[model samples]
Target: MNDKPPFPGDDPFVDSPLVDSHCHLDFPDFQGDLPGLIERARRAGVTRMVTICTRLRQEPAIRAIAEAHEGVFYAAGTHPMQAAEEPMASVDQLVALSAHPKFVGIGETGLDYHYSADSAALQKESLAIHIEAARRTRLPLIIHSRDADADMADILIREHAAGAFGCVMHCYSSGAELARTALDLGFYLSMSGIAAFPRSAEIRAIFAAAPPDRVLVETDAPFLAPPPHRGKRNEPAFVAHTARVGAEVLGMSPRDFAALTSANFDRLFTKAARTAPSRSGRQE
Candidate 1:
């Protein structure tokens, strides 16, 4: 459990603070060394992270993680992939969860037609429910779109037209059109380790075309570990690696990109930005 990954000394962004905007800290992958994982992340300049609950039933565990950690926050929703199997989540249930001080966002929810195409209708229904919750909570909707970009964009556009709400397309690797639609709607696009892949030129170009103020960085950890650690399990600490690649893709200094993305995170995940007194009663 003590075999922590070494911090990369030669990494240019080693001193810059970063945020892992999306991850699943409760997953069994890091259960053996959660504390060590957090420490490694901090040492790598990842100062904050948001652990997302993909199923509504797991909200309590996710909430507990945020409650127990100083710089961690949580979001809950029924993942579109599980939409057909999991109990349908009501807007009220999600809004109730937002009452928790650390419940900072609405979802890792959206259409995932890639593997769950059979549940398309149910996924859309679930997505709409989560969107409403985001609107009511004023928390950003964390979307997980894949393969079905047209449907995703259409639903997002229609729902947004009905009422406005903040959102971020997490782990965005969709086409240029959806990226444009999301940006035009004043939503954000989060860069994940996938964008760091050597063959991800198209993905990088999509991000490069996006407004910097609306860009975010995440690990989607326990998955998508960028190069050097690719194929290994991912953790929040690895977000810094992805950030460095993002800087390279955007032609900015790593430090500048880190700062920009962190600022963008604060802007979108506003609840996490407010200074609050920690358990020791000192402002954090």
Candidate 2:
């Protein structure tokens, strides 16, 4: 199943040390060209990817992708919307399935109010289960809070107070207050390439004031593609734009930005650790 190429490359920007903290490499959009897609990502400076789990039904497909790629990693949990289909992916199931070495994080799970309101309630319940699994497994939770900030906050605060766990609010589209609550509970905020868009002033503002150690960059790829590639399917390589944009927001060079956020990713998602070569694979 291994298809990774260790050969050195010809591209300049492809050698930087950057990581795309989240992406859906298992999705059908990527299924046709897993090897080439991963190669392109590597050539674009993306060395690692946490392929997300959206439904319990898709775990096998996602696992297969991770098994085939050398540096690819994955998570196991039904996303909020999947609660309907997998009404029983209990905290125990999440904790149990997470024993696999490649199962590094606990979710792409959290509230997403873009659909049904009933789904929102189901989403919140699912989030609690993932949080509990995260607490038990001590893996960082990959949160996906959307328009339900009030509910999302209430749940995080309540569960965190009950028993603490590592968490990262992925793609953070919420406001300052929600960000404050997540930070107050020791959660890292993962910024996607969306922050690079001109319309992301509020998201950038949150990044401007976030604690350095608590800020991580992501692509959420095959979705959220950065500028220059906006409206297209995103890939791990696009994480470079996130680091670049994040650097601008934090007032640092992209290299320093890459190093900083890579360190932050390691800090928060510890068990999913990495060791890059001295030569960073990402360049401007």
Candidate 3:
């Protein structure tokens, strides 16, 4: 007569329903074990997850994955690094994809000059297209910026002035000025596992300075796994470790921090929040 939860680990935070605001569950790493992996996320208190599709052609597979999982939602767009190779995504194509109940956001798109500076122009063009899709669909754009703070801030400010759209700077590790600009635009800043790295003091300060209500949490799993699990393969369940670090950075208890970020996620990704069910085991 053991009636506890089916998952193994205990969530240190109480009544703190967590959401892995960004992940890539459709990637090959989770291929044959999606169900078990999702259950692990649930056991760790990650009740919802948003899997991102980096290329439009992969949208069908990503969409099918979202359709198959109750707790999963998805976003699709041309990632910056691939902007040069992939066909420039049209706003119409993105808007059409938004028709699905499980499609909750417009992008994992934006500028990335770090390794793909040669395609900066293409990335900006693609980013603008995604912004338009977000504006039309009224879904938040999940942005991925890197080593292009000045241009990123300038472009975001310019586009926002042209027409307002919600956004969350996914896996944010950019400069403080960019962070300030994003917050000023009424957008969200997501804290990822990168924030938990021991050498991320400057990044930690950037997040610490952000308003609690404007912050969100993500794993960007299979990429940045946070400490203890750092340098290893990351998964949605590991988001709790990042949350624990985020809670410390914000000087709040894990429960309070988890609650705060979850509310922020809802505020930005309203579609996901609105569609999510009330209980754990129920389908959305």
Which one wins by lDDT: 1 or 2?
1
Which consecutive 10 residues in model 3 have the weakest lDDT in total? Answer: 3-12
* Model 2 alpha-carbon miss at residue 19, Å: 0.8
Evaluate all candidate structures by whole-model CA lDDT and list the values in order: 0.89, 0.80, 0.89
Candidate 2 vs candidate 3: the lDDT winner is 3
Worst 10 residues of 2 by lDDT: 275-284
Task: Compute the lDDT of residue 148 as modeled in candidate 3.
Answer: 94
Q: Tens digit of lDDT per residue, candidate 1, span 1-284?
A: 75555554345576877888999999999887888888777778777889999988988898888888778889999888899989999999999999998899998899987899999999999999999999999999999999999999899999999999999999999999999999999999999999999999999999999999999999999999998788999988888889988998889999999889988998999998884333222356
Residue 273 in candidate 1, Cα distance off native in Å: 0.5
Score every model by TM-score. 0.94, 0.91, 0.95
User: For every model in order, what is the number of clashing pairs?
Assistant: 0, 9, 0
- Kindly report which residue pairs in candidate 2 clash with one another: 15-280, 15-281, 15-282, 16-280, 16-281, 16-282, 17-281, 17-282, 222-234
The residue ranges of model 1 lying beyond 4 angstroms of the native Cα positions read: 1-6, 9-12, 276-283
lDDT of 3 by residue, 185-274 (tens): 999999999999999999999999999899999999889988777888789888888899999999999989988988888888877887
- TM-score winner between 2 and 3, please give it: 3
* Candidate 2 wrong stretches, greater than 4 Å: 1-15, 274-284
Name the candidate, 1 or 2, with the larger TM-score value: 1
